[model samples]
Structures are given as C-alpha cells and as structure tokens.
Target: MREHRGFEALGQAVALAEPPLIESSARTDVGVHRRVNEDAVFADGGVYVVADGMGGHEAGDLASAAAIEPFRALAAAHGARDYRMVEATIELARRAVDTVSLRTERGAGCTLTGVVLIEHGGIPHWYVMNVGDSRVYLHSGAELTQLTVDHSLHAELLAEGRAEAADTPRNVITRALGSGDSRHDAWLLPVHAGGASWCALTG
Candidate 1:
C-alpha cells in the first residue's frame, strides 16, 4: 500500500496478489481545509494500512500525519493479521486526530478510509471502514459494487432521492476526524469472490 499527499488531498493504494494486484486507489479531501487517504493490502489473512494527512494552517499537515502515525505504530507493534486490530487502528486514528488541539481557525480535521485483508478457512475476505466521503468499491466480473457508503450531506440527500449523483454537495462531509469528540462512524464491509475486486474513490 502507498500514501500520496497534496496541498488539498491525500491518496492511498493497495496491491493484491490473488486479485492480481488489481489497480485501486482511495482518497479523501476536507475541501480547502484538510484531507486524508489510506489503503490496505491483503494476503494470507493480513492487512497493511497507509494514511496521508493534509489539513491545518500549521496543524493540517500535523493532523493528517498524526492520524496515520498511531495506526502505523499499532500495526507495527501488533501487526495487521488480526481483524480486531484493524478496527482498533481506525479508532486510534480518530482519537489521534482528536488529540491534536487546533491552533487557530475552526480546528484541525481530516478524512480517512482503510481496508483489512483476511482469510477464513482459505477464503479471502476484505473488511473496509471509513469516515467521511472516502469511499470503497467492489468490482466483480462485469458488475461493480460500492462496498462502503459515503458519509456526507450529499449522500444523505442521495439517499432521500433529493439529489442526483452529479449534484452532490461539494466536500460537505457530515462526519470526520476532529469534527467533534462525541460522534464516530465507520463501515464494516466484506469482500466476496466471483471475479470481484475492490476500489475506494473520493472526489
């Protein structure tokens, strides 16, 4: 997996073996304020995560970097072979972002998403999680599926049939890191076979 950083966005990539290293990328952006992107690799019931940060006047970069640092440390200490650890690492990122006190402005924040690769009795599986518009998609044979649902005002509107796909709210995320300390949300997704591959896309 890899993490890419930019002035306004963050990106991640993962390579799968059985899936033949299918081309996939995940990204998240907190508009002109912040962004984070993360990815994971699956093989032999293991996962790897990479988170990129992009927020803060001085703290935006710190927030993004801080979001991933703890997860990386946890992964290094405990390894991604355990699914529970994957979830823990995610929460850790959320908490890490929260711990970063905002210097000025409305506060520091970031977007995050990741995947966990696992195998149960020889069956390969994937577990996905996200907070914000960072996305996860699955492609099986000829059909592509969205594994992780987006958490944004636009998504809420889409769910209520009040908005079109092209009319989505611009970077209006309903949830994310450092948004607050009271609420936290994420998704647990399983990857299935039958010519299926997964991708996480965000705009």
Candidate 2:
C-alpha cells in the first residue's frame, strides 16, 4: 500500500482579518510486505497530489512517476487555481501513464487523488479529483466527511448489496490512469473556517 506523511501551512495570516491559516501533516509508508514504495506526492504551488502505483504491474514506480510528472509541470507553469487547467493537467498525467504502458508492454497504472486550492471572487475553494480508490476527507468540528467515492469492485459490491463490508477485499480498484477510458471524479469545495481536509492514496 502507498501512504504519505508531511506538513503544510496554507492560506494567509493577516492580522486575523483573513481566514485562519491552515496547517497539515501527512506520513506515508510502503507497509511490511512491499520492498519499494510506489507512491508519489506533490504538495506545492497550491496543488497537492498522492498517487499509488498499481501492484502486480511491471514498472509500477515508473507508472506513478509518469502520472505525477505532468502535475509538477502544471504547478510550475499554470499553478492550480484554474479549474480548467487542473482538468487538463489530469488528462496530461493520464496520457503520460498511457505512454509508459505502451512502452512497457505490461498493463501499468496508478490511482490519483488530490486537491487544488483555488480562488473564486477572492474566496478560497478546493478543487478535488479522484481516480481508482484513493480518497479525500474533510474534518470539521467532530465530523469527518468523505469527499470522494472509491471506484472499486468492493465498493460496487457493497453498493449492490452483493457483499458485506467485512468480507470484501480492499485492493481491487475498478478504474485508474492508463486503464479503460481514464475517466475521473471531481468536486469543488468552498473552504471555510474551523475545518480542514486530507487525502489518502493506497493500492
């Protein structure tokens, strides 16, 4: 499984006139069974991403690196404030992963989950995206809300009432970069005071 750990200080602190500054910490591990960590994270230029390479695929680490490379460029070039640009950025990452798959001759892919901090009319908002089973969550005043849905067989089975949660295997994802049509889910969340958000990308 892929995991991340770090700390971030976001937003502005201007004498209490602005919204409270946000601070975050994240940590990642390769787990006991895996020899290498096939995960990538980008938390700069207002773009935060966590990508998990698909296990059992050759060059899984390369696949994840390819998926995140474009976002690094996106953050450097256009930043993450533009919603249209963020969408296009994801598409670019997908194509990069596809290129890796074509060259390796082995089905390679990764799960991507991230949030971009943007502004609309001077108000901050979060543009969240998900592919495969990575997740985003919001924490607010004793409430933890799941912000993205998992695209996984286990999730489907649970939704269809064909399996119980305890009996389902968690690693089987239904969608990913370099697989199928490469579609992804997205959301726009208005940032508010007294709350924070986090994400997890696991394969």
Candidate 3:
C-alpha cells in the first residue's frame, strides 16, 4: 500500500507540470545472453518494450523473439495509454512464454521486461515489469536507483551479503523461458513524475 501511494503521488506530481519522460535500450545474444528494456510517458500512458535475443544458441533467438512478440501485439492491440491494457498485455506474454518449447543449447532462454507511461488529468505515471536477471534502473535527478530485483540465485546471495561485489557467481539463473518452467510472473513497479526518470531492463 505504501509503495502504491508513493508511486501515485509521484505520478500525480509529474503529470501536473514535470512532463517526465522514460527511455530504455537493450541487447541480446540468445542462449548466451538476453536483455529487456522499456520506457514510458506516464505510469499508465505511453509504453515501450525491447527484448534482446541471446546469441550462441539457435533457441535463444527463438525464445527472445517469441517472448517479445506478445508484448508488441498487446501494445499494438490495446495501445500503451491504458493501464489495464498494459497489465493484461503482460499476462498475455506470460502465457505465451509458457506455451513455448525450450531448446537443447545450454543456458538457452529469454528475458522479458517492460514499462508503461500513463497520464491522468495531465499527470504522468509509469508502470514497469520484469522477469529473469534482466534489470530495470531509475535515473532520477543525479541518483540512479535499481527498480527491479533479479530472479537469480546470485542476486539472492548478494542480497544476503553472501556474495561480494557485482562479479559473477555460482547458482546463476537456473530457469527461464522454454526451460520447462511455465508461469514467469513479472515484477511490477510504478513510476511517478518529479525528477527525470528512465528504465534499463538489461539481461
């Protein structure tokens, strides 16, 4: 509730006059690595998403392409201006991932992440989602804060102080799209206007 309120207030303030903007970019080399990125004009207004294909494996590219296709269709079908439409679109993508078959190539899977911008009474707000280690960062003013938590064992260890530095570690992501696991839920966040804000959904 507190988080919701915080985002709501922030969105309202930004919509009034700040005209906050959101931008994102990413790269993917399927199976080897994949990235997801997004940007929004408001919490519920405009939205953009990018999915990078993991290289090194044939399946990686397929997975990335499959994962991103749904989001693109959703955005085109419902438009990014509607909050419910965006949420529904995510659900659609999740289902689409579940239906895909995994490839034999090692570490072959895909990452998914996105953001939506919404405006109410001229106020701008943002909604974000992520799955896998692909990340989302917020650049507000001079401060850059990570907005999404990674779904990896390494990230878990870091959170518990069991891992040091940002170096790679054991227990990396064990599952991903087409890894036989169905149902990858998106981690959602709301962005409000005030300082300049952007998203980085990296795999």
Q: Which one wins on TM-score? A: 2
Which parts of model 1 have CA positions greater than 4 angstroms off? 1-58, 77-80, 119-124, 163-168, 181-195
Ordered from best to worst TM-score, the candidate numbers read: 2, 3, 1
| Highest-lDDT candidate | 2
Total backbone collisions for each predicted model: 3, 7, 21
Q: What overall lDDT, based on C-alpha atoms, would model 2 receive against the true structure? A: 0.74
TM-score of 1: 0.61
* Better lDDT candidate (1, 3): 1
Greater TM-score among 1 and 3 belongs to: 3
| Model 2 Cα lDDT, one tens digit per residue, 31-116 | 89789888877777667888889987877778888888888877788432666677788888988898888887678889999887
- Cα lDDT of model 1 by residue, 76-155, tens digit: 55433444555566667777777774564656666666566543324344556666666656666778877555667788
Please state every model's RMSD to the true fold in angstroms.
Answer: 9.3, 6.8, 6.6
lDDT by candidate, in order shown: 0.52, 0.74, 0.51
Question: What's the true lDDT of residue 105 in model 2?
Answer: 66
> Once model 3 is optimally superposed onto the true structure by TM-score, how far is the C-alpha of residue 170 displaced, in angstroms?
6.5
